[model samples]
Target: MRLPILLLTLALPLLSQGQTADDIVKRYLDKIDGSKKWKDVKSMITKGEYDYGGIVFPFTTYAKAPSQYKFVVPFNGKYYAQGYDGNSGWKIDAFKNETTPTLLNGSQARAMANEADVELEIPFINYKAKGHQIKLEGRDTLDGKQFYIITLLKSGGEKETYYFHSTTYSLYLKKSIAKNIELEKALLDT
Candidate 1:
C-alpha cells in the first residue's frame, strides 16, 4: 500500500505536466486567428514598422487571393511584389523589373508568404513541431502582470521563444531567428 501511494504521487505530477504543455499550446493557437478564420479571408493588409537599431522603417503589405502579394515601403518609394499564379513563383521589385523564378529556403519567408495567401489561412502550418521543452526563466512584471517563459522548436531548425501571461495565458512576447533572406530590404526600398 505504501509503494502504490508513492508511485501515484509521482505520476500525478507527470500528468499535470503534460496537461500544462497542452494548455499552453492551445492558448497560443487561440490567441491568433484560427484556421477557420484564415480560410475565409480573401485579402489582408498589414501596416507595421520594422525597427533596425534606432531607426524605424514603415512598411505596408497587401495580399490578394491566389498568391498575389505586394510589400511597399513609402520611405524608399518602391514595391517588392511576388505571386504564384498556379504555375510559377515570380517577383517584381521597385525597378519594375521581374525577377527569375526563385525558391524560398527559409521557413520564415514561406510562413509569411503563406499567411499572405487568402486560401491558406493557418499561419504556422509550415512550421512542424520538433519538440516541446518548458523552463521557468523568471517572473517578468510588465504593466502590472506576470508572465511565464516557454520555448518551442520547429522541424526546419527554427526556434520560437514565447512569454505568456501567467494569469491570462496571453502572449506577452515572441522571438524567432530566420535562417535565410528571401527578399532584400534595400532592393525593396529602392
Candidate 2:
C-alpha cells in the first residue's frame, strides 16, 4: 500500500506539468492581445537589419493578407527583390557579374506562398483550418528564463518549434527544421 501511494504521489506533479496544445494555443492568443484585433489587419510592412554571413543587410518587407509578400534588400548598390503573388513567386537576385530576375518553382514557390500569408497575430490563429498539428513539449529554460515549448508540425512533415515566455506569453524564439531565409515580421518588429 505504501509503494502504490508513493508512486501515485510522484505521478501527480508530472501529470499536471503539461497542458493540451489547444489549451496552450488558446491562452497564448488571448495573452497576445486577443483575436479580435487580428481580424482588422489586412497587411503589414516592416524594415529592419538582417544579420547573416557576418554582414548586416537592411531589408524591407511588405505583406498583403491571404497570399502576397515582397522583400527588398539593397546589396552594394542594387536592390534584390523577392515577391510571391498568389500562385507564383519571383526573385531578382545579384549574381557574380550580372543580376537576374527569375521565377521560383516547386518547394521554393510553396514556401513563399506560406510565408506570404503570415499575420501579425501569431501563426496559431487558424492552425486547425490550415491542417497543422500542434504538440506541447512542456517547458524549458535558457539563460535562466523559462519558456513553454510547442512544436507545430506542418502537413508536409515540416516542423517548427516555438518557444514562448512561460509567464508573459511573449514569443521567445523559434527553430525551423531547415535553414531557410524566412521573414518573421509579426514577432520581431523587423
Residue 109 miss distance in model 2 (angstroms): 5.0
Worst 10 residues of 2 by lDDT: 180-189
Q: Candidate 1: minimum summed lDDT over ten consecutive residues — where?
A: 181-190
User: Which residue pairs in candidate 2 have backbone atoms (N, alpha carbon, C) closer than 3 angstroms, thus clashing?
Assistant: none
Tens digits of per-residue lDDT, candidate 2, 163-183, equal 877667777777653222444
Task: Give all TM-scores, in the order shown.
Answer: 0.46, 0.62
* Global lDDT of model 2: 0.72
Candidate 1 C-alpha error for residue 111, in Å: 11
lDDT of each: 0.53, 0.72
| lDDT by residue (tens digit), candidate 1, 1-190 | 9999999998985664454644665666677654556667777776655544446566666767777765554556555555544333445555455445344435645644653444334324323342334444545676788766666554444456667786577766655442214432222110
Best-fitting candidate, measured by TM-score? 2
Error of 2 at 69 (Å): 0.8
